[model samples]
Structures are given as structure tokens and as C-alpha cells.
Target: MLLISIIKTALELLVKLLELSNEGLHRLLSDAGFTEQRAKCQQRLADWLQGVARVLTQDGRQMTGSYAEGWANSMVQVNGRTAADSDIDWTVLAPGQEFHLRGGCERKGSCKDATPLQVKEGHAQVAVGAGSQPAVTATACGVRPAQDTCHAIECCSSFFKNRIRKLLPYNFDKVHLVRATRPSSTNELRVSFSFQEKDIMRNLSTDQGQLFTLIKFIFKRHLPLTLDTPGLKTYHAKTLLFFMLEKNDTHPSIEAWQPHNLIALLKESLDMMLSFIDSSSSPNECMPHFFMPDAPLYFKNAGIGGDFDNTKARVRDRLCELRSDISGVVEQLRGLVRPLQSEKFYFHPFTLLPLTAPPAVTEIRKGMYSPEMYYKFADVYSVVHQCVSELQSESSDRDTLMRQLSILQQLQWCKCATLCMTAMAHLKFGESEEAERLAMELQRHHVVSGLKPQDIQADKYDEPAKLPEDSDWAWRFCLPCDSPPRFPFLPEFTQTLFTARLSQPLSSHLYVNFRCLSWSLQAELLRNRAPAYAFDHWIKELLGDPDLEELLTLAHYSDCRWHVRLSLQQMEMIEKERRVAMETQDEENIGWVRQKWWRVSNRSGSGSDSGAHRSSEDEEEDEERRLWARARLGLVAMETAAEQRDSWTHTKVSWMRLQ
Candidate 1:
């Protein structure tokens, strides 16, 4: 009776420990910005997809994978700090999207009652309203085109060749082809069941969701397994989880998964994975796909047959080892939960930059360090700006601005941008003191250096390199091409980075641009109170900036020292045009000319097209056009014959005269 009592007490203690471990794991995940970061990553992909679809005239393309599933593990560590490994998976539909197959589709038994998330065959599925954003929204893709009627691979190739490839060096530059399959001689294709997977994933409870994240986190941190792991991909782990949940659904009232069962659940999952390996007698026998039980999820690559076998053998041994010391493993995982510390430094995974140190504006000015994360940061900045604009316009309460500022504050790497936005916000609120304070803060934004500079050499005209390997985290430097044209959606720098065939990293365009913006804000604040000559110090400093000369040398910057020069030139031109119109007393002409120049100047200053995908040649043509436009606006003569021959020059000048 005493032995029995002790056994029960020990079992209860074990359960309590597991529950505490689970809570600790949850805290760690939250601290690493998993929840918010995942959302932003998803939003980024969705926004990119929307932009791509609009450009391609294929409004049916939908983003998928971990991003769409809402369980993206953005906290995957590299060199002991979090980094984004979210490779966007999107399905590009062929023509005749809403058609039928010869026979109706048959779904898995578990998904029998579930709403058909994707259109497959004879039966049509429409998107039903859902509570959340992005995932629940579905578009009809009636059936896979019959092999006799349409060659899907050929269509994909042609689409890439004719439409997609033309946008090289800009949009779709970072895309990687993760999978391709030759199902049959006739039907070599690329397929995605993300829509079906999305339906299953959305039903996961909060505890289940955390468990999923915890597993992925464990794989990334400890086991160091990734999507590229042969026979034991992250997809297989996710599928295993789905199978476990579905199996447990038979007795729904009795929760099969609880926080207290964290270690047990992990052990069970490993045991399950081991079972698949042990039970499989041949290459043909493998772990079943969650949506299609007959289809093999593991060992799908016939070419990597030997590699898969070896990987499985290794994984099986590892799984057994893990299960044997599951408690110890749980303890190690629990150790990841550090004591809650104030967020003094937020490491931004997306940029791979730390936000710990205070601003060194002088270092940026003197060193002229080109920001490695600048373009990437600008992309995220555009998204945040849109959100800020939406909230600013919609919400009247002071709390809304504070809440937004608070969120930005948590993202410490974006110190300058945060300070810039806050200053603007305060300026809008008529708080000059606060605005000035933020401007001062912006001038002192945090910066870190001394790491080996990113190799700036890239050929924009060259075909984009293949996606970086699973182990390669420094992908930003691997394919440094022109920024995608999602312009005027939010403000971005006009000057383009010289990315092609670079011998070395250039001076800091990003920091220079930030400095320009800071000075502009300061000048605006002082426009009323301070003397006009008070701006002389700032003007002199900007004029003497070493990076100023380099900007003019860059092909894209064109006859301007910096953004401030371009902005000043643009404003002066607008005033000149306005004054001329006023002299004639032509109110209609005054409004029309003013509006036209403003749009033209903003387009020129933003340095990206109106979200259209363009080839290298097209990009060059646009660059020349911008140069001419800038010259025309500045009331200066064309310097070269090539500049004189710009096709846009005639049209723009003619339009200005007509207005």
C-alpha cells in the first residue's frame, strides 16, 4: 500500500513538471516574437503574392506552406539567434481554372465532413466566410487539367518563360522551386495541397498549436532538422501531428493532448515516427500524406533513394535515443525559457541585425557603411507604414498611436524608422516638442558593424541563383538584385543600390537616406520658429557628406548628390510651375500642373515603377526616363545625346506644356 501510494505521488509530480515545462516553452516562444513575427511574415507573403498576381494578371495565385498555415517557425536559430527561414510557397494556377475532371474527387475519411478547401475535380468548392484573415479566403480552382487537354508542366514553363522571366532582377527574384514531380511520362508537374492542409491546420486548438511550434522549435534548436532533411522533413513531422490529432478525435471529450502530457506527447510522436521506419518493408512503403493516405510523404524522391534510407536509419536511431531520455530532453527544452527580462534589445530575424546598441549617427556619416539589411528593412517598412496609415486614418484615440508605437518599439532594429514615424505622428498631432524629441532620437538610432561586409557583387542581368541550401542563412547577399517594384504603397528611398558586378561594398546609401530624412524633419519643425539661416548648419553638413558624391556616381542616382537634393529640386520646380500658372491667373492650369508634377516627382523620388514587373533592359529605360524627368523638373538641359533621346522626355514635356 505504501509502494502504491509513492508510485501515484511520483506520477503526479512528473505530470506537474511536464506542465511547468510546457508553460516555460510557451513563454520562450512568446519572448522570441513567434506570434507577432509569424503574422507579419504571413502578411508579407500574402502582400507579395497579391502584388505578384496583380503584375502577372493571374489574380488566382494563393500563398501556402507554413506561412498560410499560421504556424510559421520564424524563431529558427542560426548562430544562436533567430532568423527567418520562411520560403514562400504559392500555387500558380493554369488557364481554365474552374473546370471538371472525368470523375468526382474523393477526400480522406477524416476530411469527409470538412469543407473542401480547394477545388479538385467534378465537385465545385467555393470559399466560405471564416473568422480570421488570409487562410480561410479561398478561390475556385475546379480541377487539375486533363493531361490530354493541357500539359501542366509545359504551361508552367511557358508561363515562366514568357511572363515571369521577363520580370527578372526585380519581382520574383527570390523564388525557389522546392519540388517538381514527374507523376507520369505525360504529366510531369508541380503540385501543392496547401489548401487542403490549411483546412486541417486551422482546427488545431491553442495547446495543440503551441505543441506544433514547440516541436518545430525543438527540431531547429536541438536536433537541427530542417525541411531539407531527407526522409525526415519538417513536413513529415507536421503530417505526423495531424495524424495523431485525427486519431484522437474518436474520443473528443477525453483530451488526448494536454499541457501536462508534453513530454509524453513528444515521446509518443517520436515512437510513431520510429514505427513508420520500422514497419516499412520496402522503398514503396512510406509515411502516408495527411490529405492522401496512399501517397507517400516520406521518401518521395526516387533519385535520393539511398540518401533517404540512410537518413531514415539515422533518424530512427535518434528517435529511440530521444525517447529513452525524453525527460532529460524536456528539461533541456525548459531551460530555453529564460527569466522575463525587459526588452532592451530585440534581434530582428528578418534583417539578421541586432537592436541592442545606441545610435552612432557619426559612425554612419564617417564610415559611410552601406546597410546589408537596407532593402529588406525597406520592404518591411512599407508594410508597417501601410498599417500605421490605416490605423492613423481610422482611429481617433491617442491609445491607437501609442499601441502602434509600442509595437514598433518592440522591433528594436528599426530604431530610425520607428523614431521617424513617431516624429511624423507627433507632428501630425501638433506636438512640436514630441516631434523634435523623436527627430533627435532618429539622429541617434542604433547601429552595429565590424562583421565582414556583405559581398556587393551581383549581376542584375544574370539569371537569379538557385535558392540557398538549408544550412545557408546568409541568402540576402547570395542574390542581391534590384528591389521589387511595390512602390508608392509606402515611401521608400529614390536612390537604387549599385548591385551589379560590384568590386566591393559601397558607402552607406541607407544611412545617408535616413540622415536626409532626419534633417528634413528637423527643418520642417524649425520652419516656423527658427531663423531661415538656422538650416545652414544642416545644409553644410549634408553638402560635405562623403556619401553624397558616391550617390551621383551610381547609375540610378543620376545627377543628384542625395535624396534631399532631389526633393529640394522637385519642390523648387513645383513652386516655379505654380508661380508661372498664377501669373497667367489660370486656376485650372495651376491645379492641373501642380497635381501632375507632384505625382511625377513622387514617382521619381520613390525610384520604383507602379508595381509592374520589368526586365533589366526595361529597368534601364525607366532609369534613363527618371534622369530626364529630374533634369526637366530642375530646368536643366540634357547632358548627353542618350538622355536627349529618352522616349518619355517628349511625352512628359508635351504634357507639362499642355497643362
Candidate 2:
């Protein structure tokens, strides 16, 4: 009895040791990021084992009484199957004796004797009668198919049997419960489920074990070392936060799940993204072929509009803050970099589609003058104009210039051009003074260059010149001068040229010939008379073409009609010259007279007697007397023809008939 008691005490101590080991293993595993519910699993298993052991001890001597005696009686029911009657018995069920009950088994001797049961292949018999009416046999039921199994034992037992199915000692073809042994020195517990390939695949498909595996891999193997790398800190933090948010829809789910050094890392990442956004050039600059107005709506829709005035106000405030920050950075950069003097710096304008006036302009106006800021605005206007010009040149399908002009007209630099064009448009409406004033202002700034009035007098000359009613002939005359006197000749010559060009077909050709002749005659005449006047007049006539009069008139309309008065004086001078040349009777003098007469006739077809008549008459009367008569007659005929053509032509013919 003492030896038996000692053995029992040793066994009890061994059981206690096992329980303590199980408890320590459970605690270690739980602390290792294992499921916390696993503690309840361990406690339940211990209770089950203890119940099995107590039942076995109580029924040890009653094996012959019923199928429930001894180990068979202590066999736990699993998944609705009695262990003794199950074909695939669990390892936890001990070998037991089979008992058969006869009919009316209230008599002790009526029941069959006990036989050692083959726990693997035996059946159980239950009493149903007093005599040996063949014992009511109950066939052993095969272990419930794994699919119908839900008990933790069944799951574990199936897992164990599958793992070592090919091994000899475990070749009973029955699932068995196996407990993992604790390592001798370690306090940590490792609980592993041996799942079949199909079970693993199913669990994976459902994402059941994925979260746990990821957590284990990250915390156990990846975290500390990954966090140690400074370069990866921000990236990993953002990734972790993104993943955490994705995993749980509820924000509270991640409230306790803090990544290592996450806050600092997130702040760094945000700063980096912001820096990238600010420093990167706008898409418009990078891709200029894209029309700014037609750029994606996302850029347009980025800010508030319409009734969201409050939101727009807040956005403007934020923009002001951002601008200030950027300005500080730019100043620092400028100080450090010291850009080349000729290098152009540009700022992109803030363009709002469906533009609303910005309120920040008021604040900006209060700052001290900055040349850089001034240039920035100027550059924006310039770039916009360049873009407008480019678009206009390339495409006729769109009115890009007009649209850009409309937008830019509000700006000061662009306003000049807009005002100039507006003035031109106003000119057609008879606001002549307004137009001229605006034009002058525009020209002063070099906004619009080289705009002057245009002469309307050419239109008046479209009809042919008409003779006065009392005139004997219709006469038009042009005096071609090489270099005429400034006071009298230059102005007359310019008027004749203008009139001839407007009324006569041979004006241009005659003007050239007369210029050469006039220069020779004037040089000779002034050789003994006013040389300075001659030189000055030569310059004036040479410089003043027909266009000069028209240009002056168009440009300065109120200027006097100097050209018309000069023409009358030139006619009188021609009469005087003819008379003086006649008395001289010099052929050279007559040649000058003939050339002048030709020019006059070519221009207006209204000059006096032809040079042929003057030469013939001078020869007939010893040259001098006949020349005088010819000169007098030429003068009279020139005046008559200048008056009217019909009577003059008839009178000349009648004189010829009389001769």
C-alpha cells in the first residue's frame, strides 16, 4: 500500500507538472502576439482531460456490467459518437473490455462475461433481453467523417492522423490527439495546427490566416530592422497607415495600432509631397501645345466657385499663406543663387476659369515695391501674349487671340493695346478727337506705333478737271521742276505734280523729264541770281513728291493750302520767262521754252503755241523780231487755251486757214 501510494503521489505530481507546463506555454504564446482567446482553449482542454480521467477511475471495476464501464464507460462522446463504438478511436481513449448483456440482465449471471475489446475493430453490445437471445449487437460506427466534425479534439485528431499516416505505430488509421511537448529550458509556448493541404488552401482563400501571418512576419521579423533604416522610415510609415486604414473601415480599429515612429515619419512624408507640388513646374509650362482654356477640368474644378463664397474665402486665405511661404523660399534662393542680370524670372498667373476677382490684391498692394514682383506680372502678360500669338498663327479654327485678349484686357500692360484698338473703332463713329487723343497716348507708350491720318482728297480728283464757263479752252498743265525755289517754285511744283498724278495719265513720266530740265534752267537762272534760294528750293522740290502734299494733308489737315497758291505763282513765272527768252532770241533759250511747253501740254494739254511755231517764227523775222511776235502770240494762246478748249482750237485753225 505504501508503494502504491507513492506511485499515485508521483503520478499526481507528474500531472501537476504537466498542468503547470501547459499554463506557462499558454502564457508565453499569448504574449507572442498569438490570439488571446487561446487561453480559454487551454483551460477547456484541461477540464476535458480531467473529466475523462475521473470517469475512468470510477468505472474501472464495472466492465462486465455495461458498455459504459472502465475506459469504454469513460470514453467521451465526440460529435455524437460513443468512443467505444467508433471504428477510428482517438488516442485519448484507452483499450477497454467489451461486455454483452443477455435478456433480463437484472440477474447478474444472465449477462455474458467480459472480453478484452479490440478498440480498433470491435463492436459494443447493449442488453435488451433476459436470456441469450443473441445479444443485441451494435456495429462499430466509423469515426464521423471529418466534414461533420466540429469539436476541437476532432480537428486536432484529424490533423495529427494526416501528418503521420504513413508511420507504423500510428498506422491504426484512426485520428489521435497529440500534445506538443514544451522545450526543457524555454518558457515560450508554440502551438501549431497541422492542417491538411486542402484545409490550408481553404483558409488561405478565405483570408483567415493571412492577417495573422502578416502580423507575425512584420512584428517578429521585419519591424525593428526596417524602422532602423532612415531612408525607408517615411515610406514604411505611410504604407503601414494606408494598409491599416484599408484593413478596417472603422477608424477606431487602428486607434491602438501605432507603427513605430509613425508621427514624425508621416510629417516628413507630407512635407516631401508638398515640396514636390510647389517646386514642380506647372503642367501648362511643360506641355504648351495643350490649350490652357481646354486643359482638363480637374485643374479648373480644383477651387470653389458660385455660392461657396465662404469656402472660396477660406481657400484664398490658404493661398495667401502658401504664397507667403513660397515668397520666403524664393527670396532665400535668390539670395543664395544670385541669378544672372539678364536672366528672366517669371511667375505663373493664377488663372481662374469663370474668373472671380481676387481679394488678395488689396493686401499685396500694401507691400513695399519689388522689382521682381513687377517683372513677374509683366512676364505673365508677355507669355500670355506670346501664347496668344502662337495660337492665332497656328489655328484659324479657334479665336484664341480674341479670347486671350479679352482676359488680358483687364491688366495694365495689355490695357494699352486694348485701348488703342478701341480708339480706332471709335474713330469710325466720328469721335475723331477722342480717337486722336487715345492714339497719341498709345503711341507715347509705344503700344501702337505709326498711326497717322489718311487723306481723302484723292477721291475728289477721280472726276476730270473742268474748265471755267468763260474759258476759251479746257487746259490742264503740269510744270515739272528739277529744283524750284523754296518760297515760290517748290510749293508750286509739288502742287502741279499732285494734280497731274491725280488727273493726267503722263504725270509720272513728265514729272521726271521736267525735273531734269528744271534743274538745268534754275541753275542757269540762279547762277547770277540768289544761289542760296536756288539750292534751298532744289532741296524742297526734290524732297517733296506728290505724296508729300497728301501725306501732310492726311497727317495735319488744318495746315494751309500752300500747294495751290504756289501753282498760280508758277503759272505767272512761266509767262514772264517766255517773254524774256523771246527777246533774247537764243535757240538755247527757246529749247528751254519748248521743253517747258511740252511738259505743260503732256500734263494738262492746255499750254501755248508749240516749240515748232516759236522756232519757225524766229527764223522768219531775223530771229529777234519774229521771236518777239511768237512769244506774244504763244502767251495769248496759252491764256486762251487755259480758259477753254473749243473756241481756242477753232480760232487756231481759222488763223491757220487765213495764213
lDDT of 1 by residue, 409-522 (tens): 544444555566567566556677887777556444533311111111122312121111121122111112122222121112222211221121211111213334444454
Report how far off residue 329 is in candidate 2 (Å): 55
Point out the worst 10-residue segment of candidate 1 by lDDT.
140-149
Best by lDDT: 1
lDDT (C-alpha) at residue 421 in model 1: 58
lDDT of 1 at 639: 57
Candidate 1 achieves a global lDDT of 0.39
Quality of model 2 by C-alpha lDDT: 0.26
Error of 1 at 190 (Å): 5.9
**Candidate 2 lDDT tens digits, 1-659:** 99999999999988655533423322222233222122122222222222222232222111111111111111111111122312211122223421222211222342334331111101112222122111222222111111111111121112223322322222332232122112121221111121222122121210112222232222222323332211112112222323333333213224322332222323333343234334434321111101111111111122324223332233234334433333332222223221122211110011100011111111111111322223323233233323323332323222443443354444553444344333423333445556555544443332111111111011232221111112111011122212221211221222222221212121111111223223332322232333302333433432322122222221111111232223323433433423111112122222322332323333333221222223333344233322332342243466543443344345445534654
